[model samples]
Target: MELKTLSEIDIISASTSKINQVDFENLTFGNVFTDHMLVCDFENGAWQKPVIKPYEPFMIDPSAKVFHYGQAIFEGMKAYKDTHDDVWLFRPDENFHRFNKSASRMAMPEVPEDVFMGGLHKLLEIEKNWVKKGKGNTLYIRPFMIATGHGVIAAPSSEYRFMIILSPARAYYSGEVKVIIAEHFSRAANGGIGAAKAAGNYSAQFYPTKLANEKGFQQIIWTDDATHTKLEEAGTMNVFFRINDTLFTAPTSERILDGVTRKSVIELAKRENINVEVRSVLVDELIAAAKDGSLKEIFGAGTAAVINPIVGFSYKDTYYELPKIENSMALEIKEKLTNIQYKLAEDTFGWTVKI
Candidate 1:
């Protein structure tokens, strides 16, 4: 497919700036959006010219396929501002590829690189002020596509809308996180849409997650669907378990998301001489390790949290508490990773791209 050039995109500036009114220090995750957004439409078997315009609600038919059949996909990313007041994107190429992968899995049209990357670059350039220069402050990027065809049919929609919205974020999780191990509720089945960042996959988890929330748990460590014997994911991110000195994580499959942060953590761990193993940790094995004092750490890695340490986990009728330890590998790796992101340290892996 021929990629569209940046010059082909139309720019519509907002009449006013909302930056003066926004409290960047007290910003919530994904709540406050920037002044402008990037939008592109897919119609008549081809992608239309992209547009950068004011961030505002647009009309969508009540009978849109997204409302009925749930043909939607999205990607979460972030833009960092270094001390030099320059903006940089961390592995955006990965998110672009993953977004298209989800689109393909959902039977939606794949977005061209020019429309996705080129449009994002232009949009971020226009909203660079939103990318605050600090360690914790960042501009969260959400690129999503939804079926816009006005039809209630079960088939895929012929028309779709892709958009990129920016939000200034502080942190995704606050305080220690406690999670419940799922025994009955399955996140995704074998050969399901779990691997794809489809909207339905997240909506299906809301009920079970809410139940866990009521029980004083912040998240749920989803087990494999069939037997619930293997730990797969933790909430919306890929999970990692540290037993003794080895870090173990489930391999990406039909039922697990191949997260960018998850893979980066694995590589960073190896570079730091941390023993890393890419395999599913059986539920029984985890329980045994917890009993034997081998389960040292549990952390969730994703674009939002980077690396969220799990304070403890509840399984079946018993709750197991992990011992607090100093010099945690989770925190250590997170520090190194964030340093590379903020340009405080050399990016030997070449993950960060300047805007």
Candidate 2:
């Protein structure tokens, strides 16, 4: 596929604006969307000219391969508005590279950088007003591709549709989170599509998460599938465990998704002279730490929540509550990262990109 220029994209302005109808002060995460969206079709072994048009549903065949074989992938990102009214993206290139990596894992075509990043730039420029200026206020970016080839056969699709949509979002979670450790359910196995951002990977977790939710837990800390002994992820995000001041998180493998926020957190912690170890924390080890006074904190990192501190965790019907502390490393790191995202503090790592 040949790379194309941004000027080739077709633009169609919306007939009317819905900005006035929305109440920015109060928003449900991922419920509302901007007026315009970016779309590009893939066929004949090549990506077509991209289009930026009004946000609305488009028809698809009932037997599309995505409905059968699940040839789909997506990426989560955000656009933030600074005090100067400039829109910015945090580690967008990382998302772009990971998006293609997921595409390859799912047997889908890779989208060109121009179609992905350029289209995003053009789309956000039109919807700049949708990005609210303040900490915790952002325009959630959802870029996804799905199999569009019409067939019920169990195979990869010949056609695909790539799209980018924007949604105004506040905080993802409000209350303290309690998690249950997985014993039977497995999120991914060896040589599975667990590391990819494929749609099925998320769908596979719904049933187990629903079960956990029924038991009065907000999420589940998934363990390794083979033995269900090593802590891998919390809900849909990468998890970290702070044992007596040293941060420990499982290294990314075939079973764990390499989260951008997770990497950022590790780097930021190191920069702040905090000890961070990239190694798997065994379930037994964690239980021992919890029994003693070593286990101080457990948190999840991802693009959505940034950092979600776990109040406690349940393992083998035993609940272990984390002690309340005045100056928490999780809160401190979250504040520093969010400040960088909102441009309130100096971005010493050169992670933020202006648009």
Worst 10 residues of 1 by lDDT: 1-10
lDDT of 1: 0.93
Worst 10 residues of 2 by lDDT: 1-10
* Clash count, candidate 2: 0
Every model's TM-score: 0.98, 0.98
Model 1: CA > 4 A from native: 1-5
Q: How displaced is residue 116 in candidate 1, in Å?
A: 0.5
lDDT of 2 by residue, 88-150 (tens): 999999999999999999999999999999899889999999999989899999999999999
**Which tens-of-lDDT digit does each residue in 115-191 have in candidate 1?**
99889989999999999998999999999999999876799999999999999999898888999999999889888
The list of candidate 2 runs beyond 4 A from truth reads: 1-5
